[model samples]
Target: MDRVLLTKKGAEALQAELKNLKSVERPKVIEAIAEARSHGDLSENAEYDAAKEQQGFVEGRIKELESHLSIAEVIDPSKLNVQGKVVFGTRVTLYDIDAAKEVSYQIVGDLEADIDQGQISLSSPIGRALIGKSEGDEFTFEAPSGEKTYEVVSVSYDV
Candidate 1:
Protein backbone atom coordinates (compact mmCIF):
# COMPACT_ATOMS: atom_id res chain seq x y z
CA MET A 1 0.00 0.00 0.00
CA ASP A 2 1.04 3.58 -0.60
CA ARG A 3 2.16 5.65 2.34
CA VAL A 4 -0.80 7.35 4.00
CA LEU A 5 -0.54 11.00 5.07
CA LEU A 6 -1.87 11.89 8.48
CA THR A 7 -1.71 14.87 10.81
CA LYS A 8 0.02 14.42 14.14
CA LYS A 9 -3.34 14.38 15.87
CA GLY A 10 -4.74 11.90 13.41
CA ALA A 11 -1.79 9.58 13.88
CA GLU A 12 -2.13 9.77 17.65
CA ALA A 13 -5.82 8.93 17.43
CA LEU A 14 -5.11 5.93 15.23
CA GLN A 15 -2.39 4.80 17.60
CA ALA A 16 -4.78 5.03 20.54
CA GLU A 17 -7.38 3.01 18.70
CA LEU A 18 -4.81 0.36 17.83
CA LYS A 19 -3.69 0.15 21.45
CA ASN A 20 -7.29 -0.24 22.64
CA LEU A 21 -8.04 -2.90 20.06
CA LYS A 22 -4.94 -4.90 20.86
CA SER A 23 -4.90 -4.57 24.63
CA VAL A 24 -8.60 -4.53 25.46
CA GLU A 25 -10.87 -5.59 22.64
CA ARG A 26 -8.66 -8.40 21.38
CA PRO A 27 -8.34 -9.98 24.82
CA LYS A 28 -12.05 -9.58 25.52
CA VAL A 29 -12.97 -11.34 22.30
CA ILE A 30 -10.49 -14.13 23.02
CA GLU A 31 -11.95 -14.68 26.47
CA ALA A 32 -15.46 -14.64 25.06
CA ILE A 33 -14.52 -17.22 22.45
CA ALA A 34 -13.05 -19.48 25.12
CA GLU A 35 -16.13 -19.15 27.29
CA ALA A 36 -18.38 -19.89 24.32
CA ARG A 37 -16.30 -22.91 23.34
CA SER A 38 -16.69 -24.35 26.84
CA HIS A 39 -20.47 -24.50 26.38
CA GLY A 40 -20.37 -27.78 24.40
CA ASP A 41 -21.24 -28.29 20.71
CA LEU A 42 -19.70 -25.38 18.74
CA SER A 43 -21.70 -25.96 15.52
CA GLU A 44 -25.06 -25.48 17.25
CA ASN A 45 -23.96 -22.76 19.67
CA ALA A 46 -25.21 -19.27 18.91
CA GLU A 47 -22.83 -17.80 21.51
CA TYR A 48 -19.89 -19.46 19.84
CA ASP A 49 -20.93 -18.18 16.42
CA ALA A 50 -21.36 -14.63 17.73
CA ALA A 51 -18.01 -14.75 19.51
CA LYS A 52 -16.25 -15.97 16.41
CA GLU A 53 -17.84 -13.26 14.29
CA GLN A 54 -16.79 -10.60 16.77
CA GLN A 55 -13.29 -12.04 16.85
CA GLY A 56 -13.06 -11.72 13.08
CA PHE A 57 -14.09 -8.09 13.19
CA VAL A 58 -11.66 -7.27 16.00
CA GLU A 59 -8.76 -8.99 14.25
CA GLY A 60 -9.56 -7.31 10.98
CA ARG A 61 -9.60 -3.89 12.62
CA ILE A 62 -6.29 -4.63 14.34
CA LYS A 63 -4.68 -5.47 11.06
CA GLU A 64 -6.10 -2.40 9.36
CA LEU A 65 -4.83 -0.08 12.11
CA GLU A 66 -1.43 -1.69 12.11
CA SER A 67 -1.11 -1.32 8.36
CA HIS A 68 -2.14 2.31 8.46
CA LEU A 69 0.24 3.14 11.29
CA SER A 70 3.12 1.33 9.66
CA ILE A 71 2.89 3.43 6.51
CA ALA A 72 1.63 6.65 8.04
CA GLU A 73 3.55 9.88 7.39
CA VAL A 74 2.54 12.12 10.22
CA ILE A 75 2.67 15.83 9.49
CA ASP A 76 2.57 18.51 12.13
CA PRO A 77 0.77 21.57 10.83
CA SER A 78 1.95 23.82 13.60
CA LYS A 79 5.55 23.19 12.69
CA LEU A 80 5.13 24.50 9.17
CA ASN A 81 5.48 28.09 8.07
CA VAL A 82 3.99 28.44 4.62
CA GLN A 83 3.93 32.27 4.58
CA GLY A 84 0.10 32.47 4.81
CA LYS A 85 -0.61 30.38 1.72
CA VAL A 86 -3.13 27.61 2.07
CA VAL A 87 -1.37 24.26 2.24
CA PHE A 88 -2.00 20.88 3.74
CA GLY A 89 -3.29 21.21 7.32
CA THR A 90 -4.28 24.84 6.85
CA ARG A 91 -7.39 26.03 8.65
CA VAL A 92 -8.93 28.29 6.03
CA THR A 93 -11.80 30.64 6.68
CA LEU A 94 -13.73 31.32 3.52
CA TYR A 95 -16.61 33.39 2.29
CA ASP A 96 -19.15 31.48 0.26
CA ILE A 97 -19.95 34.03 -2.38
CA ASP A 98 -23.03 32.38 -3.79
CA ALA A 99 -24.46 31.36 -0.44
CA ALA A 100 -23.50 34.67 1.19
CA LYS A 101 -22.09 32.84 4.21
CA GLU A 102 -18.80 32.30 5.95
CA VAL A 103 -17.33 28.94 6.79
CA SER A 104 -14.07 27.41 7.83
CA TYR A 105 -12.43 24.22 6.68
CA GLN A 106 -9.16 22.51 7.40
CA ILE A 107 -7.37 20.71 4.62
CA VAL A 108 -6.33 17.34 5.95
CA GLY A 109 -5.43 13.85 4.83
CA ASP A 110 -8.18 11.38 3.95
CA LEU A 111 -7.70 9.48 7.20
CA GLU A 112 -8.52 12.60 9.23
CA ALA A 113 -11.07 14.30 7.04
CA ASP A 114 -14.34 14.63 8.88
CA ILE A 115 -16.81 16.88 7.10
CA ASP A 116 -18.82 17.38 10.25
CA GLN A 117 -15.71 18.84 11.85
CA GLY A 118 -15.02 21.07 8.84
CA GLN A 119 -11.96 19.03 7.85
CA ILE A 120 -11.77 18.17 4.16
CA SER A 121 -9.54 15.72 2.40
CA LEU A 122 -6.70 17.30 0.43
CA SER A 123 -8.04 15.49 -2.62
CA SER A 124 -11.51 17.01 -2.29
CA PRO A 125 -12.57 19.56 -4.90
CA ILE A 126 -12.66 22.51 -2.52
CA GLY A 127 -9.41 21.49 -0.91
CA ARG A 128 -7.71 21.24 -4.26
CA ALA A 129 -9.04 24.65 -5.24
CA LEU A 130 -7.79 26.26 -2.05
CA ILE A 131 -4.28 24.91 -2.19
CA GLY A 132 -1.48 27.47 -2.59
CA LYS A 133 -4.05 30.24 -2.23
CA SER A 134 -3.42 33.19 0.06
CA GLU A 135 -5.74 35.44 1.99
CA GLY A 136 -8.23 37.38 -0.20
CA ASP A 137 -7.82 34.86 -2.99
CA GLU A 138 -11.02 33.76 -4.70
CA PHE A 139 -11.43 30.42 -6.38
CA THR A 140 -14.23 28.36 -7.89
CA PHE A 141 -14.79 24.67 -8.18
CA GLU A 142 -17.62 22.58 -9.52
CA ALA A 143 -19.60 21.09 -6.69
CA PRO A 144 -22.53 18.71 -6.87
CA SER A 145 -24.77 21.76 -6.47
CA GLY A 146 -23.03 23.51 -9.36
CA GLU A 147 -20.15 25.97 -9.62
CA LYS A 148 -19.31 27.24 -6.14
CA THR A 149 -17.07 30.21 -5.45
CA TYR A 150 -15.25 31.09 -2.26
CA GLU A 151 -12.93 33.84 -1.08
CA VAL A 152 -10.19 32.96 1.32
CA VAL A 153 -10.58 35.28 4.28
CA SER A 154 -7.85 33.83 6.43
CA VAL A 155 -5.50 30.90 6.70
CA SER A 156 -4.08 29.68 9.96
CA TYR A 157 -1.82 26.82 10.91
CA ASP A 158 -2.38 27.05 14.66
CA VAL A 159 -3.32 23.39 14.70
Candidate 2:
Protein backbone atom coordinates (compact mmCIF):
# COMPACT_ATOMS: atom_id res chain seq x y z
CA MET A 1 0.00 0.00 0.00
CA ASP A 2 1.05 3.62 -0.49
CA ARG A 3 2.52 5.46 2.45
CA VAL A 4 0.59 8.20 4.24
CA LEU A 5 2.32 11.49 5.08
CA LEU A 6 1.93 12.91 8.60
CA THR A 7 3.66 15.51 10.70
CA LYS A 8 5.00 14.51 14.12
CA LYS A 9 2.23 16.31 15.95
CA GLY A 10 -0.41 14.97 13.60
CA ALA A 11 0.76 11.40 14.10
CA GLU A 12 0.76 11.84 17.86
CA ALA A 13 -2.78 13.20 17.75
CA LEU A 14 -3.96 10.23 15.69
CA GLN A 15 -2.29 7.79 18.08
CA ALA A 16 -3.94 9.48 21.03
CA GLU A 17 -7.32 9.26 19.31
CA LEU A 18 -6.76 5.58 18.61
CA LYS A 19 -5.92 4.93 22.21
CA ASN A 20 -9.02 6.80 23.37
CA LEU A 21 -11.19 4.82 20.97
CA LYS A 22 -9.86 1.46 22.12
CA SER A 23 -9.74 2.15 25.83
CA VAL A 24 -12.66 4.52 26.39
CA GLU A 25 -15.06 4.64 23.45
CA ARG A 26 -15.00 0.89 22.83
CA PRO A 27 -15.85 0.04 26.41
CA LYS A 28 -18.55 2.72 26.57
CA VAL A 29 -20.22 1.37 23.44
CA ILE A 30 -19.98 -2.20 24.68
CA GLU A 31 -21.60 -1.24 27.97
CA ALA A 32 -24.34 0.62 26.16
CA ILE A 33 -25.01 -2.41 23.95
CA ALA A 34 -25.19 -4.69 26.98
CA GLU A 35 -27.61 -2.41 28.76
CA ALA A 36 -29.82 -2.19 25.69
CA ARG A 37 -29.77 -5.97 25.24
CA SER A 38 -30.95 -6.38 28.82
CA HIS A 39 -34.10 -4.38 27.96
CA GLY A 40 -35.46 -7.47 26.13
CA ASP A 41 -37.72 -7.61 22.99
CA LEU A 42 -35.07 -8.16 20.31
CA SER A 43 -37.59 -7.56 17.47
CA GLU A 44 -38.64 -4.01 18.42
CA ASN A 45 -35.79 -2.75 20.54
CA ALA A 46 -34.96 0.75 19.36
CA GLU A 47 -32.36 1.25 22.12
CA TYR A 48 -30.57 -1.93 21.09
CA ASP A 49 -30.52 -0.85 17.43
CA ALA A 50 -29.15 2.56 18.28
CA ALA A 51 -26.45 1.07 20.48
CA LYS A 52 -25.51 -1.36 17.71
CA GLU A 53 -25.23 1.48 15.24
CA GLN A 54 -22.99 3.44 17.59
CA GLN A 55 -20.85 0.36 18.09
CA GLY A 56 -20.43 0.02 14.34
CA PHE A 57 -19.33 3.65 14.04
CA VAL A 58 -16.83 3.30 16.87
CA GLU A 59 -15.38 0.10 15.40
CA GLY A 60 -15.09 1.62 11.95
CA ARG A 61 -13.23 4.64 13.33
CA ILE A 62 -10.86 2.39 15.22
CA LYS A 63 -10.06 0.43 12.09
CA GLU A 64 -9.48 3.59 10.08
CA LEU A 65 -7.11 4.99 12.69
CA GLU A 66 -5.17 1.76 12.81
CA SER A 67 -4.90 1.62 9.03
CA HIS A 68 -3.63 5.21 8.89
CA LEU A 69 -1.08 4.68 11.66
CA SER A 70 0.20 1.55 9.98
CA ILE A 71 1.15 3.40 6.82
CA ALA A 72 2.01 6.78 8.39
CA GLU A 73 5.31 8.35 7.39
CA VAL A 74 5.75 10.80 10.25
CA ILE A 75 8.08 13.69 9.46
CA ASP A 76 9.57 15.79 12.24
CA PRO A 77 10.75 19.12 10.87
CA SER A 78 12.84 20.18 13.85
CA LYS A 79 15.09 17.14 13.56
CA LEU A 80 15.79 17.67 9.89
CA ASN A 81 18.78 19.55 8.44
CA VAL A 82 17.03 21.34 5.64
CA GLN A 83 18.16 24.84 4.67
CA GLY A 84 15.91 27.90 4.26
CA LYS A 85 13.55 26.35 1.70
CA VAL A 86 10.04 25.66 2.93
CA VAL A 87 9.24 21.96 3.32
CA PHE A 88 6.68 19.68 4.92
CA GLY A 89 6.04 20.55 8.60
CA THR A 90 7.88 23.85 8.29
CA ARG A 91 6.07 27.09 9.09
CA VAL A 92 6.24 29.66 6.33
CA THR A 93 5.55 33.36 6.75
CA LEU A 94 4.51 35.38 3.73
CA TYR A 95 3.72 38.99 3.01
CA ASP A 96 0.62 39.25 0.86
CA ILE A 97 1.18 42.17 -1.47
CA ASP A 98 -2.42 42.48 -2.51
CA ALA A 99 -3.81 42.33 1.00
CA ALA A 100 -0.94 44.35 2.41
CA LYS A 101 -0.66 41.98 5.35
CA GLU A 102 1.54 39.16 6.58
CA VAL A 103 0.32 35.58 7.04
CA SER A 104 1.82 32.40 8.35
CA TYR A 105 1.07 28.78 7.53
CA GLN A 106 2.53 25.47 8.54
CA ILE A 107 2.77 22.89 5.80
CA VAL A 108 1.36 19.61 7.03
CA GLY A 109 -0.24 16.39 5.85
CA ASP A 110 -3.63 16.26 4.16
CA LEU A 111 -5.36 14.96 7.29
CA GLU A 112 -3.77 17.62 9.50
CA ALA A 113 -4.64 20.58 7.33
CA ASP A 114 -6.75 23.05 9.31
CA ILE A 115 -7.26 26.44 7.71
CA ASP A 116 -8.45 27.96 10.96
CA GLN A 117 -5.26 26.85 12.67
CA GLY A 118 -2.95 28.19 9.99
CA GLN A 119 -2.05 24.70 8.85
CA ILE A 120 -2.11 23.91 5.14
CA SER A 121 -1.65 20.60 3.42
CA LEU A 122 1.40 20.14 1.25
CA SER A 123 -0.87 19.30 -1.66
CA SER A 124 -2.72 22.62 -1.40
CA PRO A 125 -2.12 25.31 -4.01
CA ILE A 126 -0.21 27.76 -1.78
CA GLY A 127 1.60 24.98 -0.01
CA ARG A 128 2.70 23.45 -3.29
CA ALA A 129 3.94 26.83 -4.43
CA LEU A 130 5.85 27.41 -1.18
CA ILE A 131 8.00 24.35 -1.69
CA GLY A 132 11.64 25.18 -2.41
CA LYS A 133 11.00 28.90 -1.84
CA SER A 134 13.48 30.79 0.33
CA GLU A 135 13.20 33.97 2.33
CA GLY A 136 13.06 37.28 0.39
CA ASP A 137 11.64 35.49 -2.66
CA GLU A 138 8.69 36.92 -4.57
CA PHE A 139 6.10 34.56 -6.02
CA THR A 140 2.56 34.61 -7.36
CA PHE A 141 0.06 32.18 -5.87
CA GLU A 142 -3.13 31.16 -7.67
CA ALA A 143 -5.63 31.67 -4.90
CA PRO A 144 -9.29 30.68 -5.24
CA SER A 145 -10.31 34.30 -5.73
CA GLY A 146 -7.53 35.15 -8.14
CA GLU A 147 -3.77 35.20 -8.62
CA LYS A 148 -2.26 36.81 -5.52
CA THR A 149 1.27 38.01 -5.19
CA TYR A 150 3.20 37.12 -2.04
CA GLU A 151 6.75 37.50 -0.83
CA VAL A 152 8.41 34.88 1.29
CA VAL A 153 9.33 36.46 4.63
CA SER A 154 10.59 33.56 6.71
CA VAL A 155 10.70 29.79 7.05
CA SER A 156 10.92 28.11 10.43
CA TYR A 157 11.30 24.46 11.39
CA ASP A 158 10.36 24.79 15.01
CA VAL A 159 8.53 21.84 16.46
Candidate 3:
Protein backbone atom coordinates (compact mmCIF):
# COMPACT_ATOMS: atom_id res chain seq x y z
CA MET A 1 0.00 0.00 0.00
CA ASP A 2 1.10 3.56 -0.61
CA ARG A 3 2.38 5.34 2.45
CA VAL A 4 -0.17 7.74 3.94
CA LEU A 5 1.25 11.06 5.05
CA LEU A 6 0.16 12.12 8.53
CA THR A 7 1.13 14.98 10.76
CA LYS A 8 2.33 14.15 14.27
CA LYS A 9 -1.02 15.21 15.76
CA GLY A 10 -2.98 13.17 13.25
CA ALA A 11 -0.94 10.07 13.96
CA GLU A 12 -1.43 10.55 17.66
CA ALA A 13 -5.20 10.80 17.23
CA LEU A 14 -5.26 7.56 15.28
CA GLN A 15 -3.17 5.83 17.90
CA ALA A 16 -5.49 6.99 20.64
CA GLU A 17 -8.51 5.62 18.79
CA LEU A 18 -6.80 2.28 18.31
CA LYS A 19 -6.02 2.11 21.99
CA ASN A 20 -9.62 2.91 22.95
CA LEU A 21 -11.02 0.28 20.60
CA LYS A 22 -8.74 -2.39 21.93
CA SER A 23 -8.92 -1.57 25.61
CA VAL A 24 -12.53 -0.51 26.05
CA GLU A 25 -14.73 -1.20 23.05
CA ARG A 26 -13.43 -4.66 22.27
CA PRO A 27 -13.90 -5.91 25.79
CA LYS A 28 -17.35 -4.39 26.10
CA VAL A 29 -18.48 -5.97 22.86
CA ILE A 30 -17.18 -9.33 23.94
CA GLU A 31 -19.09 -9.09 27.17
CA ALA A 32 -22.24 -8.06 25.35
CA ILE A 33 -21.91 -10.97 22.96
CA ALA A 34 -21.47 -13.39 25.82
CA GLU A 35 -24.51 -11.99 27.60
CA ALA A 36 -26.59 -12.29 24.46
CA ARG A 37 -25.46 -15.88 23.98
CA SER A 38 -26.57 -16.74 27.51
CA HIS A 39 -30.15 -15.73 26.62
CA GLY A 40 -30.50 -18.99 24.61
CA ASP A 41 -32.71 -19.43 21.48
CA LEU A 42 -29.90 -18.46 19.13
CA SER A 43 -32.21 -18.43 16.10
CA GLU A 44 -34.56 -15.73 17.42
CA ASN A 45 -32.27 -13.75 19.70
CA ALA A 46 -32.50 -10.02 18.81
CA GLU A 47 -29.85 -9.14 21.37
CA TYR A 48 -27.41 -11.57 19.77
CA ASP A 49 -28.04 -10.11 16.34
CA ALA A 50 -27.52 -6.55 17.49
CA ALA A 51 -24.42 -7.48 19.45
CA LYS A 52 -22.99 -9.29 16.45
CA GLU A 53 -23.58 -6.28 14.22
CA GLN A 54 -21.93 -4.00 16.74
CA GLN A 55 -18.98 -6.39 16.95
CA GLY A 56 -18.56 -6.34 13.19
CA PHE A 57 -18.56 -2.55 13.08
CA VAL A 58 -16.12 -2.21 15.96
CA GLU A 59 -13.76 -4.79 14.51
CA GLY A 60 -13.90 -3.18 11.12
CA ARG A 61 -12.99 0.21 12.54
CA ILE A 62 -10.15 -1.32 14.55
CA LYS A 63 -8.73 -2.96 11.45
CA GLU A 64 -8.99 0.26 9.48
CA LEU A 65 -7.22 2.24 12.16
CA GLU A 66 -4.48 -0.36 12.45
CA SER A 67 -3.90 -0.41 8.71
CA HIS A 68 -3.73 3.37 8.53
CA LEU A 69 -1.32 3.54 11.44
CA SER A 70 0.87 0.86 9.89
CA ILE A 71 1.24 2.78 6.66
CA ALA A 72 1.36 6.30 8.10
CA GLU A 73 4.43 8.50 7.68
CA VAL A 74 4.18 10.81 10.65
CA ILE A 75 5.83 14.19 10.17
CA ASP A 76 6.42 16.57 13.07
CA PRO A 77 6.33 20.21 12.02
CA SER A 78 8.45 21.33 14.93
CA LYS A 79 11.28 19.02 13.90
CA LEU A 80 11.26 19.94 10.21
CA ASN A 81 14.03 22.17 8.80
CA VAL A 82 12.31 23.93 5.89
CA GLN A 83 13.90 27.36 6.66
CA GLY A 84 11.35 29.92 5.33
CA LYS A 85 10.00 28.09 2.32
CA VAL A 86 6.58 26.46 2.35
CA VAL A 87 6.68 22.68 2.76
CA PHE A 88 4.65 19.88 4.24
CA GLY A 89 3.56 20.76 7.79
CA THR A 90 4.61 24.38 7.37
CA ARG A 91 2.09 27.06 8.40
CA VAL A 92 1.83 29.64 5.63
CA THR A 93 0.34 33.13 5.72
CA LEU A 94 -1.00 34.44 2.45
CA TYR A 95 -2.50 37.68 1.25
CA ASP A 96 -5.43 37.28 -1.12
CA ILE A 97 -4.84 40.02 -3.63
CA ASP A 98 -8.36 39.99 -4.97
CA ALA A 99 -10.05 39.94 -1.60
CA ALA A 100 -7.49 42.16 0.06
CA LYS A 101 -7.39 39.88 3.10
CA GLU A 102 -4.81 37.77 4.88
CA VAL A 103 -5.35 34.05 5.50
CA SER A 104 -3.21 31.37 7.08
CA TYR A 105 -3.05 27.66 6.38
CA GLN A 106 -0.96 24.72 7.33
CA ILE A 107 -0.03 22.25 4.60
CA VAL A 108 -0.60 18.72 5.79
CA GLY A 109 -1.42 15.25 4.56
CA ASP A 110 -4.79 14.33 3.10
CA LEU A 111 -5.91 12.62 6.29
CA GLU A 112 -5.04 15.68 8.36
CA ALA A 113 -6.64 18.28 6.15
CA ASP A 114 -9.32 20.19 8.03
CA ILE A 115 -10.23 23.49 6.42
CA ASP A 116 -12.09 24.64 9.51
CA GLN A 117 -8.88 24.24 11.49
CA GLY A 118 -6.72 25.92 8.84
CA GLN A 119 -5.06 22.68 7.77
CA ILE A 120 -4.89 22.06 4.04
CA SER A 121 -3.92 18.96 2.07
CA LEU A 122 -0.67 19.17 0.19
CA SER A 123 -2.39 17.90 -2.95
CA SER A 124 -4.88 20.78 -2.93
CA PRO A 125 -4.51 23.54 -5.52
CA ILE A 126 -3.52 26.25 -3.05
CA GLY A 127 -1.22 23.95 -1.16
CA ARG A 128 0.51 22.85 -4.34
CA ALA A 129 1.01 26.48 -5.35
CA LEU A 130 2.36 27.37 -1.93
CA ILE A 131 4.93 24.61 -1.74
CA GLY A 132 8.58 25.69 -1.99
CA LYS A 133 7.53 29.35 -2.05
CA SER A 134 9.16 31.93 0.21
CA GLU A 135 7.74 35.06 1.71
CA GLY A 136 6.86 37.92 -0.69
CA ASP A 137 6.35 35.54 -3.62
CA GLU A 138 3.14 36.08 -5.58
CA PHE A 139 1.24 33.51 -7.59
CA THR A 140 -2.03 33.30 -9.47
CA PHE A 141 -4.37 30.40 -10.12
CA GLU A 142 -7.80 29.84 -11.60
CA ALA A 143 -10.59 29.47 -9.09
CA PRO A 144 -14.10 28.30 -9.74
CA SER A 145 -15.45 31.85 -9.65
CA GLY A 146 -12.53 33.60 -11.32
CA GLU A 147 -8.75 33.97 -11.35
CA LYS A 148 -7.30 34.51 -7.90
CA THR A 149 -3.89 35.85 -6.92
CA TYR A 150 -2.11 35.58 -3.61
CA GLU A 151 1.15 36.77 -2.11
CA VAL A 152 3.09 34.64 0.33
CA VAL A 153 3.30 36.72 3.47
CA SER A 154 5.14 34.32 5.77
CA VAL A 155 6.00 30.68 6.36
CA SER A 156 6.84 28.95 9.60
CA TYR A 157 6.83 25.57 11.33
CA ASP A 158 5.13 26.90 14.41
CA VAL A 159 1.46 26.01 14.63
In order, what is each prediction's RMSD in angstroms?
A: 1.2, 1.3, 2.2
Please list the residue runs of candidate 2 whose C-alpha ends up more than 4 Å from where it truly belongs after superposition.
none
Per-residue alpha-carbon lDDT of candidate 3 for residues 2-110, written as tens digits (9 for 90 to 100): 7799888888888998899999999999999999999998899999999999999999999998998888888876786767788888889999998999999999988
How does model 3 score by TM-score? 0.84
What is model 2's C-alpha RMSD? 1.3
lDDT of 2 by residue, 1-47 (tens): 66789998999999999999999999999999899889998779998
- In angstroms, the error of model 1 at 155 is 0.6
Q: Lowest summed-lDDT stretch of 10 residues in model 3?
A: 75-84
Error of 2 at 108 (Å): 0.3
Using all chains and alpha carbons, the TM-scores for the candidates as numbered come to 0.95, 0.94, 0.84
Ranking by lDDT: 2, 1, 3
For residue 24, give model 3's deviation from the true position in Å: 1.5
Candidate 1 residue-wise lDDT, 92-151, digit = tens: 999999999999998889888999999999989898889999999999998877899999
> Cα lDDT of model 1 overall?
0.90
The weakest ten consecutive residues by lDDT in model 1 span: 75-84
lDDT of 1 at 147: 98
Deviation in angstroms for 87 in model 1? Answer: 1.0
lDDT of 3: 0.89
